[model samples]
Target: MKFLRDILDKVKPNFEKDGKLHFLHSTFDAIETFMFVPNHTTKRGAHIRDGIDLKRTMFIVIIALVPCLLFGMWNVGALHYAAQNIDSTLLENMLYGAMKVVPIIVVSYLTGLGIEFAFCQVNGHPVNEGFLVSGMLIPLIVPADIPLWMVIVATAFAVIIGKEVFGGTGMNILNPALTARVFLYIAYPVEMAGEIWVSGIKEGLVDAASGATALGVLGGKDLEAASNYSVNVMDAFMGFIPGSIGETSVLMCLIGAAILIVTGIGSWRIMLATVIGALGMGLILNAVGGNPYYDLPAYQHLLIGGFAFGAVFMATDPVSAAHTTTGKWIYGILIGVLTVLIRVFNPAYPEGIMFAILFMNVMAPLVDNYVVKANIKRRLNRVKA
Candidate 1:
């Protein structure tokens, strides 16, 4: 560590003002900080410094995502072989999965960080580590077999349009990862979904092989039909099923959630409220009993699709989600309720968390405003009384 720090110190001068590499100072700073925490501190004024900074916070979320990433990679390999009735060892599965998953992750980081660094150079500001999390998230949210070119386009779209357009990461209204997903979804609906769930899966390879996800099966039929198709609670929860790279495993998502909550980085209120809202809405649909999907158990909603992943990671994005304590509950509940509603109502497309989170991102500020105003009013009334 000391050796690396010394090397950075030696090269730092060249990237300082009026130096030969001054033009790339932002880029250098990004690399340096990533390797080591900034030692420079305030010399004046009374400032309360926390143990962690933005980069550190982003890394914490990345740490939380590690379990999901590893599981997703193995699951991809498992599904790929299972689709063709090939029985392979765990190492073989992971090796194949790594070949597919790693490139997407590389493209995501390179594309996003390249754009961010370029913006920083042009804007003459420090490069924010915001894309660190978003880059990992993009790869995880996408299918393992998605084209590299599409990832480039979607990542560029996410960084430039979803984030940079709104004045960089902290200023963005929507989650960049979800933005990339939505872009892919809208631009290439056929590629974004369906058989992309499994890598290199051939058609009619076996009598009992299907590439469709649990949610995909549920989209067209009732709970019983979906179950009959082998979409059950245990398989989905354990992530031994076909779905997006990281979203297939509810257990992994919960593990990520635990890390986030333990580190005090993610909002537990949002997580809990989202779950409650989803169950509440699911119960209502069950009461109506108008369709097979409506008959799905409320608890099952948390176990399938991207509900757990979205609730744990996407909905709790600090920048896009509601900030106020009371507002978080509202923001999260709406996300959960809307997700179930969209899934139940729109059988053709049941992956509603993406749209629901984006919609709530727009409304988060409004929710916060109302929460703030209500708090102020209540305080004034209490004083008068």
Candidate 2:
């Protein structure tokens, strides 16, 4: 450590103010700070000092996401092999999955960080740590088989339009990862949707296996007909179904959720309210009972599609989500309700959490405003008494 610090100290002067390489200050600072916490401290003004900085906070999120990434890789390989009716060793499965999944992750990080670095250089501002989490998240939410070119384009679009255009990270109105996803989904629906989910399916191995997800199956036909394609609830719960890379596994997402909550990095209030809202909406739909999709079990809704992943991860984004405690509940519940409503009512999009979260991200400030107003009103009433 001391050796590395000495090397950094030697080079650091060149990137400091008024030095020949001063333009690269943000880049140097980003690398140096990532390697070790900054020794510099505040000399003035009130500031809360903590061991955890933005980089460490984002690193914690990355730690939580590791379980999902590993499980997603395994699921991708397992689904691909299952589709072809080919038995594969677990090692083979993971290797094959990694071949498909790792590139997307790499491209996401490289493209996103490249743009972020460019922005920091141009603006002469310190590099934000937000992309550390966003980079991992973009690949996780997309199909493993999505084109590498698309990943590059989407990542660039996310960093430039979604975040940088709005003054970067904390100022962005939408989740940058979701923004990239929504861009791909809308601009290239054919590639983002349909049977493209399962990797190795393009090899044309088996006719018996279908790439239609559980949510797709339910939305596509009546309950009896869908039963032929429906993934068992247990399989969905266990993440054996074909869907988005990381979203198929409710179990993995829950494990990630537990880690985030335990570390105090995630919002439990938002998570709890989101689940209740989804269940509540599902129950309401079940009671209406006109269509087989509506009659589908409420609890099952939480297991399938992107509901679990989005509720645990996307909706709880600290920057885009509601800031006030009460507003978090409203924001999360509305996301859940809207997700179910969109899935059930609009059969065109089988997965709704992406749209739901993006929509709620836009509404989050409005929700917070109302919550704040209410709190002020209550305080005023108490003073009057």
Candidate 3:
């Protein structure tokens, strides 16, 4: 460590002001900060510091997401061969999954970081580390077969319009990963649709007949509304079903959730409230019980589609989520209710977590504002007494 520090110290001055390589100072600073803790500190009174910083927080999140990533890779491979009715070994499946998932991940990081680096250089600012997480997220939320070009365009749009326009990272109003996903989903519906989730169906090499997601089947308009949903809920729970890469397995999402909660980075209040709200809504639909989709077990909503993923990951985003304790409960419950509401009622889309989280991101501040005001009002009454 000392030897590496000495090496960095030797070249550090060259990237400082008026140095020959000063043009790449932001790049240098970014690398230096990533590799080691920044020495810069406030001399004045401020909150006491700790080892945890933004990068560390984001890194922890990346750690939490690993279970989902690894499982998503294997799931993709397993599904590809399953779709084609080909016998394959576990190693072969894992390898095939790697081949498909890795390129998407590479494209995501390269495109997002490329834009982030460019923006930092142009504006003479330190590169924000937010994309370290967003880059991974964008890949997870999209189809495994999603085009590299689409990943490039969505990543650029996510960095520029979704985040940069609102001032970078912590200032962005919406989650950047979901921004990339929603952009691709709206702009290229066919490409972003269920068929592409399985590797070869989108290319016409495999039949698309069985490629539908649980949500797609449940929400189908052409069904006998009273017919039993044919999908195995347990498979969906285990994440063996066709869907977005990282979102398939409820078990993996739970593992990620456990890590975030244990580390105290993610809000357990939000997680619990989101589940309660979703189950409550599901129960409401069950009582009204006009349709087979509504008749699905209330707990199953949390297992299917992106509900669990969004609750664990998207709703827990510290920046966009409501910061007030009361506000978080409100924000999370609304996300749950809205997600199930849209899933049951919306004709255009089957999944609702993406829209649900984004909408709450926009409304989170308002929820916090009201919570603050209510608290102030109660305090004023006590003071007057």
State each model's CA lDDT, in order: 0.90, 0.89, 0.89
Per residue, candidate 2 scores C-alpha lDDT tens digits across 1-385 of 9999999999999998899999999999989988997787899999998887787789889998999999999989988888887999899889988999999999999999999999999999998798999999999999887879999999999899999999997999999999999999989988887677788656665342478777777777456776455458899898988888988889999999999999999999999999999999999999888877887789988998999999998999999999999999899899889999999999888888899999999999999999999999999999999
Instruction: Give the per-residue lDDT digits (tens) of candidate 1, residues 1-385.
Output: 9999899999999999999999999999988977886787899999998888897799899999999999999999998888777999999899989999999999999999999999999999899888999999999998887889999999999999999989997999999999999999999987776666778853444333377776777786556666565447789889998888998899999999999999999999999999999999999999998666778888988888888999999999999999999999999999999999998888766698889999999999999999999999999999999
Q: Estimate the TM-score for candidate 3.
A: 0.96
* Pairs that collide, model 3: none
Q: Candidate 2 — which residues are off by over 4 angstroms?
A: 206-209, 221-224, 227-231
- Sorted on TM-score, highest at the top, how do the candidates line up? 2, 3, 1
Where's the lowest-lDDT run of ten residues in candidate 1? Answer: 201-210
Off by more than 4 A, model 3 = 1-7, 44-47
Give per-residue lDDT, candidate 1, residue 75: 93
**How far out, in Å, is residue 92 in model 1?**
0.7
Q: Give all TM-scores, in the order shown.
A: 0.95, 0.96, 0.96
Q: 1 or 3: which has the higher TM-score?
A: 3
Error of 1 at 148 (Å): 0.4
Sort the candidates on lDDT, descending order.
1, 3, 2
